[model samples]
Target chain A: MSASATPVALGAARPGLFGFTRAQAVGFLLMLAAIVVLPHVLYPIFLMRILTAALFACAFNLMIGYVGLLSFGHAAFYGMGAYVCAWTLKFWHLDAAAAILLGGLTGGLLGLALGYLAIRRSGIYFAMITLALAQMVYFFCLEAPFTGGEDGIQQVPRGTAFGIFPLHQDMAMYWLVAGIFIAGFLLIHRVIHSPFGQVLKAIRENEPRATSLGYRTMHYKLIAFVISTFLSGIAGATTSVVFGIATLDGVTSARSGDVVLTTLVGGLGTVFGPVVGAIVTTSMENYLAQFGSWVTVTQGAVFVVCVLAFRRGIVGEIAAKLRLSL
Target chain B: MSEILLETHGLTKEFNGFTAVDNVDLQVRAGTIHALIGPNGAGKTTCFNMLTKFLPPTRGRIHFKGRDITGIAPADVARLGLVRSFQISAVFPRLTALENVRLALQRARGNSFDFWRSETALRRYDNRAHQLLFDVGLTGLADTAAGLLAYGQKRALEIATTLALDPEMMLLDEPTAGMTHADVDRIVELIRSIRTGRTILMVEHNLSVVEGLCDTITVLTRGRVLAEGDYATVSRNPEVIAAYLGSDAPELAHA
Candidate 1:
């Protein structure tokens, strides 16, 4: 095979406005421009909601796409981070950045512990183990008092950054959310291109061969899991601050499934696929809210279609046609 | 005489009540091709597995380079400069041929986790991998994905990967089991070239290939060593003739 036939590095020469690949960078810049400009023309609250979901979807993709590990219980970490941040901000009166960091740490710890066990198996078993463990966390959240159970922790303080800069408005929160999303995206990109990422791909391709080649495959899997969950936690913390709520909905299996659906729709192992998938799916959920059960039916149908006919996903399909690795 | 590189004492394998390999003592000298030929159900592959540390012997001691490594992990065994190629090709299908050799070199050099440097920049590894590919006559297909390579090419690549480890000894189980005549001839030639530097212990079924490539041959039947010596002596032995060729044997009549 020719060297060109192999998948190349992401955003090699043409880094967009936000350090994304040319296409993503261009699309993201346009989206950012729209976020800044269109909010005046459209509703700021609606856009913020979409942007938050997009960030969460991108974080989820860090695991599924780059690492090739399907996490069904990502919502457990996401919801846990959200709850930890919300509770800390509301009861302990912590700053927003600190709360988000605390949320990320919590998610990382959970990932470290759960990933150790889940990575013992591969393929479908790995997915099931993660889902089952996440369910345990979900049950704990439902019963835990700090989480406020069905009521959720409400009126979380969207405290200032470092006690100086106030993020009291939607515009300010949008910038923060966008910045966090971009950072997470860049980190994921760095990891996928790094030598560490190459080993993960090697493991994904053939675990036995990787092991025989002297790799501690389980260690790599755990690290990837932790990184993925930690990013997912950042999204959760941001969501809590933006909406001033933390609930069991974030930790539910359905919520986890939603992230998978988004990643799959965007692209299974593609970098920008999850972001695009998140944006499109969140918008569909928002507009189809009035359609009741049909919204779920429609989402399920999209997932089925993506899996059966478009396994490469929207971003993957585009990349294949254009002969790019984006 | 060459130095002994691999030695086993009381090497035995038991699967439940049945003993697959029973008290087989073996010593492979350096820089010679040692062929272990056996009929079906003979414990040749099991013995290979034991030597490579893939399967722990039920009762035995294996010493490689004067170090006891009876129950070490397979990776550890490979790291110790004793590598084994599988009966079936086990190359990474997704990786290109160069990448596969590069991975082996990385492991052999204990650099499996060197994440910061680009693989392309590792000139030493890249050059050695390229050289090994050339040595195996796979220089033309360096960029081919191992999975896409032809059967003969895959086998050649497997040998190249094994060589990338820079092993002192090689344990190859059925290297030419499924190859065509041309492929088999190519493998025999490759084995011949490789035996100049490292001790090679191979399990082969084809008598002609065994006679052509092996300096010493150990004939096995029903989990026991039936005959041992050079091909000329073992081929003429009555026990080997009875066990391997059976009663209707044209070669035995000539002998």
Candidate 2:
């Protein structure tokens, strides 16, 4: 094996942190600084919203951007996580960390079940199956007694961290949310640059070829699906905890659409695109709340502009122009 | 002359009542280049698909290394040290040449499920991958994306990735289908150099490549084996000449 004595040194240099390029490392540092400083400049709650949205978009990007599996019913995991987290905090009296972990587990379990069915088919059919299954989850949430129907699980206590640190303070909750977002973001980066991620990219590039090379493409796709949904669940649970409510809005198809929009606007495949996209889109919605329906009109206009003018989204276009993976 | 490494019995495929490959049996001895040469519509690819388990046979059984493999998955078939290359060069186009070979080399690290570990863990494969590329004369193009390479170079990269598997047997489908003469000769030499200690099953339209590189040739016509022999014996068969060579039989005999 490999008996030839050629000394080709193309891959001699190791990548920067977590396989990130130097530019990407710098970008990551800048993002960290922003996360740290932005809470003081902007309202902490608004910043938290952006953070949760960014986390959710990043999770969703794992499917569409990397694995090429566009999950149209991601709201199932997110909304289910929210409902479960709210229930645990309100009824079980679990701390914030425990509740969120339970919520994330709920998402993962739901993903395992639904992803099993959805991944049986591919392309639009896969998207449709996830949508249908998620719709079922939405209906279950709507009809379930614990979800409180239209009222949802309201006034979910923010509770304490590890039974010690209280999360009632906006700054405390912001820190927790920010920490989750950063962890989720770094975890995703690690996954994307890992050996498993290389196989996933190969499958995305040419699945049949990957299969011929002895990779179980379905298994890889399924695992990626579960990871994506698990993270989406975390984001949703955190949102419910922050807002003190778990409502039907969290499970609506519109939530799924919002995530897809954010990922698209930020960049489809780039590592940091979803975070940038979440910041832009979530900020727009928060600031334009006074403008009512015009917010959607503005969003639609921006989406159109992005699609036509820069198909790569904001980060994608930047990465393409600069020849650096952001 | 040696033990049969791959053997098929009554393998058939039917698509909507149209039989693509009829009941055809084939065998390849271990460590020899076997060629499946046929006319344009002779079911060579369909038969190759069945052997690779890419398509489930309508009725058949395939034995690889004396184990039944007809009912297994394509990836499972590959994992058993029986790999196949596509007629069209099937490199992961976006990946660089080194990355393409590194992909096949990664199975050495057990399974491809280490998503939590950084890709730097895969750097161990770089040297071996580079060697495989060099084996196929792609040393200078290791950094180039597979998509950006010239056609011959892309085909060579495919071979490099295939070699990274170190398969016991390889199924090459039309390894020199569309090529300049120089490229074809280069591929022939590449195949010749890599043939030691491995069995190769190939589908070819280029009879001269078969004559030069293949130890045994199986000629197919109308989804059935028409002749099986070494270069001179099969080339002289009147039926093979009439069906596959037609009026060009004399020129083929000379070749």
Best by lDDT: 2
lDDT of each: 0.79, 0.89
Output the worst ten-in-a-row residue range by lDDT, candidate 2 chain A: A1-10
Model 1 Cα shift for residue B202 (angstroms) = 2.1
Q: For candidate 1, write residues A215-281 as lDDT tens digits.
A: 6677787888888888888888889998999999999999999988988888767777887888778
- The regions of model 1 sitting more than 4 angstroms off are A1-68, B1-3, B14-19, B56-59, B109-111, B114-124, B246-255
Candidate 1 chain A TM-score vs. reference chain A:
0.90
- Please give the clash total of every predicted structure, in order: 0, 0
Positional deviation of residue B233's Cα in model 1 after best superposition, in angstroms = 3.1
Against the correct fold, how does model 1 do in TM-score? 0.86
Off by over 4 Å in 2: A1-14, B245-253
